[model samples]
Target: MVHVYTGDTMIETTEEHPFWVEEKGWVLAGELNEGDVLRLKSGENVKVTKLERVDLKEPVKVYNFEVQDWHTYYVSDINVLVHNKAARYNTPTPVNPKRVDTNYLKKNGIDPHSLKYDTLGDGADISKYNIYVDKNGELWILKNGSKEFIPTYESIGR
Candidate 1:
């Protein structure tokens, strides 16, 4: 998922990557038009607009190792496998919460060890982002001015 920081808020979009033979099953980030539909790394199809505006300028932040080896260790085969597992680890299967959510595990009961928080770094400003966990057990980093990106469990407690 790629997000554009448009002064006030962020705009999100789902853009498909051109096929690459190196690694399979990754989504490349790029500009997202208004009505584009693409398959997520989770194998589920999502259409843009659950949150708000879609940005057409920001580059798609591709998380696949096959596309770009931004992370040095991720270039390895073993690391790729580990990353693949991490990507799906503890990820929610159902998209969102419906009536009578059985997964209400209580924020107070959530052990600090179980729930991890990472600072966006010193120079990075995420003030416009509203952080929230959905009823489906997915952690969302939403741009207050826009919409939510597909939540991934990869960065949690790592």
Candidate 2:
């Protein structure tokens, strides 16, 4: 049986289902482990009495970006057994271009300077080019001061 911890009460479930615990937040029923403590919705503590691991019908593969190679480690998302040629360690690390240094950007053929933009006095023409860095650190080229952004890589060579 699976138990769900509500803030003020504990409910026993005959089958696996989504469970919410105050301390651990929302989690799938299959993720629960024996001896795990949870706070009920009423702020009472309860321990998981039983847990069973469920085997997935099909295993899933995950991949991370390779900064040195400037591409994903795996050729396809489904191929998880293939090892990354350039990875130095077993731990997975993903590369985000926005967080990289200017030199790194240049090494990857991205010009950090191209991302700079100046205010062209208010009410600028829609066809004007505006280069700016987004919150995620990716560079974008905005045209006509519109919400649509063209990725830096797409416009870099041209």
Candidate 3:
């Protein structure tokens, strides 16, 4: 039996929540009321003998990663950037901008070296396969044969 603390209130349960177990790397008691037995990882069974309420000085915090400024391209719209005349007609899966490397851009008919950077200035290089948002908030790309701004869903839907 192990003592599982849920906030300031202690309860006994058979197993701690999987999230708490993975995060703390310890067998914490989770969601027990009265008279519960918990089995430990070592196969030893423990019973909840007592429960007590204690005040916590601070609230617990959980952290998770969030991506910012990420761009996604749809299958139908890929033809605008892909250079291969044959593949241009085929529907491709949605792709992240970062996954498009310099070699892939060249195969798709884009001359990375000759493309002009948008507002990002000199630091922005076409070889990196970067997609940019223009002043009008539309997605734009520069390829070997085309010099037009591509309309994104946001612009087209409206």
Candidate 4:
């Protein structure tokens, strides 16, 4: 068993247990490291503080359940949300860009296939352009390097 101390709250579970993350989504406790961030009940981001292994003299029994509607629920006692066993270590599935989505990128002179992708990084640092689409579908160019690239943005939608 592993005791995860993250963002003032802690959870005790197997290394295979998955924890909900903000930008990266579900990640296994074993894969989690200090300096990584997790999400709280209030939708706030919290940094992972530490992790410890438990030496058990006897077996520790744990319970399991099925949540058909939402596979995730909050541990109110610890004030943190966790995904059910069914979603253990679940990562975002790669989806081929839609025709319109691809066309939109191509229209902006971005080669859709040229974009690098790594689920482990969760769509981060994939593009040399440093561009991302906001919730409102607005394209934002984040500042990079020595801050020579002035941050700029434009409204876009599918």
Best by TM-score: 4
1-158 per-residue lDDT for model 1 (tens digits)? 44523223343334332211111223333433433443322223334333334555766554544312111112211111112222332323435523211143243343222222221212224454444554555454444464434232322222
Worst 10 residues of 1 by lDDT: 72-81
Best by lDDT: 4
**RMSD of candidate 4 to the true fold?**
11.2
Determine which window of 10 residues in candidate 4 has minimal summed lDDT.
146-155
TM-score of each: 0.28, 0.24, 0.21, 0.55
Ranked candidates, highest TM-score first: 4, 1, 2, 3
Model 3 poorest ten-residue lDDT run = 73-82
Residue-by-residue lDDT tens digits, candidate 2, 30-118:
56566566433222345666554534477545333333422211111221111122222122222232333557557657644433221
Runs in model 3 lying further than 4 Å from the true structure? 1-30, 62-158
Comparing 2 and 4 on TM-score, the stronger one: 4
Supply candidate 4's per-residue lDDT for 49: 91
| Tens digits of lDDT, candidate 3, 91-145 | 2222332223457546645433433332112333445334434444333343334
> What's the ranking of the predictions by lDDT, best on top?
4, 2, 1, 3
Q: Is candidate 1 or candidate 2 better by TM-score?
A: 1
Ten contiguous residues minimizing lDDT sum, candidate 2: 72-81
Q: Residue 61 error for model 4, in Å?
A: 0.9
